[model samples]
Structure formats: C-alpha cells, structure tokens
Target: MLFTKGGDGKVIPRCRIKPLSAKNVVVEGRDIDVQTFLKVYRQRVHGLRFIFDKNVRRRSDLASEFEGRIVLTLKIASSGEVENVQIKLTTIAENSPFSAINEDVKESVSHWKFPKTKNGATFSFPISFYMMLPQPSMFDDSSSIKNK
Candidate 1:
C-alpha cells in the first residue's frame, strides 16, 4: 500500500483494501487486517546500539600514532547475528589500521545480540558504530615531549 502526504503534510492513506473472500482468508476473523499484519512486521524489526569502551586494543604491529573516528555499518539478521559488516567511514592513520579495526569489529559485532519481538519473527536491520582513537594524557610531561 502507498501512503502520500496531502497539502497540509498529513499522511493520506491511498490504498484501496479489497473485500476479502473465503479463498483469500488465511484466518477468518474481523481482527485480521492489513494493519494487523503491518503492525506485526514493524514489531519484528528493531535497532540496537553497539557500545565500545574508550580503550580499544590497538594493533601493535601497525603504525602506533593513530587517531580519528571509524564508522562501521552492519546488517544484522532477525536471529540477532551479524550478516555483514562494512566500514562506512574511517580516519585511521594508515590503511593497515583501518584493516585491523575492520577485522576486529567484524569479529566482535557478529556475536552481538539484538532485542527480540513477542511474535518471534526475524528481521534485518542496519547499524553504525563510531570508534575514536585513544589519546595520551596531556598532563604527563613525558607524553607532552613525545607529542612535540
């Protein structure tokens, strides 16, 4: 069904619901309607947040002084498993750091869980995470010399 906005910006329901016949009846009840089906589907799909701590394990072999935000896009299945992970944005110091972080996120997010619905229906959803590079303390005199 298609919905469009009217002049006043209110949604105008545009779909014509045809009369249900006995052959078309999956379940015979007044409560069974298109709205009910839509509601059920909507309930199945959900968004989840991926929280990362300030201190992430860095790849020692890669360039050490890395800093910036890394945005990851993930597609999660209805069973709460990650189907795919993509790097939407990354500001790492080198390509190796980006690859390392990408591998780490893919491994971690795959085991993450999304909330389940009452009907037990599975749905796919996209999520993004922002990762910040760790910074050394400005109060430390040794670190200040290193920064210069």
Candidate 2:
C-alpha cells in the first residue's frame, strides 16, 4: 500500500496496483506500465519463471553463482500462433542447466498464442536467471542466495 497526504493533511491509502488504462494491447512494449502489464501480460508470461527455475535446478555444480540473461525473438502468425522462437543472445554459458533454459523456452514458446493482429508480429524479450539459487538447508538456517 502507498500513502499520500491528502489536501486536508489526512493520509490517503492507495492500492498497490491501480489500473491506469483499460486497453489490453500495447503499441510498444516499453509503453506498457507495470500495473497494466500485470493485468494484460499475465496470460502471455505465466509459468515462465517456473520453467527457468526448473532448468537451473538441473545443474548444481557451479563454482560460484552467476547472473545472466537470454534474449529471444519470437514470431507469431496472423492467427496468433507462435511461428518461431529464436535465441538472439545470452550472457550465460552455453552448457548444461544454462543451455537447458533456452531449449525449454523455445519448445514451450513455440506453442504459445498471442492476440491476433493484421500481419502478425515479431518481438524480442529477455529472460534473466541466477545460478545456485540458494535456499536454507535443514542443517543450516543461515544459508542465503549467492550473486555475481
């Protein structure tokens, strides 16, 4: 919650996310605000974080925790079906756990559906991940996440 002093000097509470607009379609990705994105883009991005976490857990042998990103270009058809998912760039190693993220993303996104458009569209976005995502063990309560 956010609070602001009213004109009468009374504090007014605001909800975490108050919709700024009713439109679901955004002309440019950056033009979409966080509040609007959560309402409109939820269907497009749901479960992606889970996929990244699942892939990262596949490999636990990192000398040190690492932070990286994987940028992808996706093309969708007029019917809203994803035509392709291409890895444009990545800062992570091209090896296990890391590479698995790309593979799974591509496969999963290949089946995603977006809002239909006149000529379809192509968009590029990034997925960032951290290695050795730390969690406290049963034997130690002080364990914490590692960062680069």
Candidate 3:
C-alpha cells in the first residue's frame, strides 16, 4: 500500500480499493465486499510508514551482513481494527538483528486499525527490507576509486 501524510499528520492510502466479490459476503456473513473492506481499511490504518522507515536504520546497521523480507498476513475486523498478524516468511537468521526487526514490524503492524465492517477480512502482503551504504561524492576524485 502507498501512504501519504494527511494534513493532520496521519497516514493515508494513496490508492483506493477496487471492486470486490460479494459472494464471500454471504459465506462470511460480512456486510461489505472485499474492495469496500479494503477501502475503508486503507483510510483508517496508520503508522504503516513507520514500519517501512525503520527499515532504513536496520539497513545501515546490517546491510553488508544481511538482507531480508517478511511476508505478513493480517486478519482485520470490520470495526477497523487489527485482529491478528503473522509472519509468513523471513530470511533473517533466527538470532540475528534482522530477526528482531521482523518481530518489531509484526508487532507494530498488529497494533494497526482498519476500517470497520460487518465482517472481518484476511489479506496477505510482502514487506521487503534491505540497506546499502551511500556512495562517495563524484567530485571527490582524490580517493582514486576504480570504475567497476
């Protein structure tokens, strides 16, 4: 999801949700369809950018040593609340700093709130994290760096 800050300093979804299936409404007993569920959700959820921004620090600290991605699956209530969050995949070593980052991201996302609806929804998305060092200034030729 793309996020932009609102005038009140809240995170807002850049894109609205598209049309969704209504058949699941009857099966799930939810009043809203998938798109409606997501549209409402995207509007209310906040602090998502925080999770992505934090990755920059993680990258600087562990960039040369490791890189990783976490696939998160969330269960959202119709009331615009997060019911559950799970890490579906990760490449960080179990005891590494990236592992801690993974857990931190999951915990942060769990506390997120979505748009309320009559029925809860389940969705999966991937968040990839990595870091790199800044290159030297092009004008500084004294260091004599070779062209790769």
Candidate achieving the largest lDDT: 3
Q: Estimate each model's TM-score.
A: 0.34, 0.56, 0.56
Model 1: lDDT of residue 71: 49
Question: Which parts of model 1 are misplaced by more than 4 Å?
Answer: 1-64, 93-99, 118-148
Clashing pairs in 1: none
Residue range with the least summed lDDT across 10 consecutive positions in model 1: 45-54
lDDT by residue for model 1 over 20-120, one digit each (tens)?
A: 23333232223234344334323432211111221222332222343345445554454535456566555543444345544554466555544442222
Cand. 3 TM to true fold? 0.56
lDDT of 2 at 62: 44
Locate the minimum summed-lDDT window of 10 residues in model 3: 12-21
How many clashes (backbone atoms < 3 Å, residues ≥3 apart in a chain or on different chains) does model 3 have? Answer: 6
lDDT of 2 by residue, 1-148 (tens): 1233447743332212112232422333432333433343355454565565555444434413545666677766777687777888877567545666667777877877665656666666665544332222322536765787
Error of 3 at 17 (Å): 21
The residue-by-residue lDDT of candidate 3 on 1-148, one tens digit each, is: 3334448743332221222333322223344455665564355333443544454344444444444566667777777687888888777667765456677778887877655677777766555443333343422459796899
List runs of model 3 lying over 4 Å from the truth: 1-61, 138-148
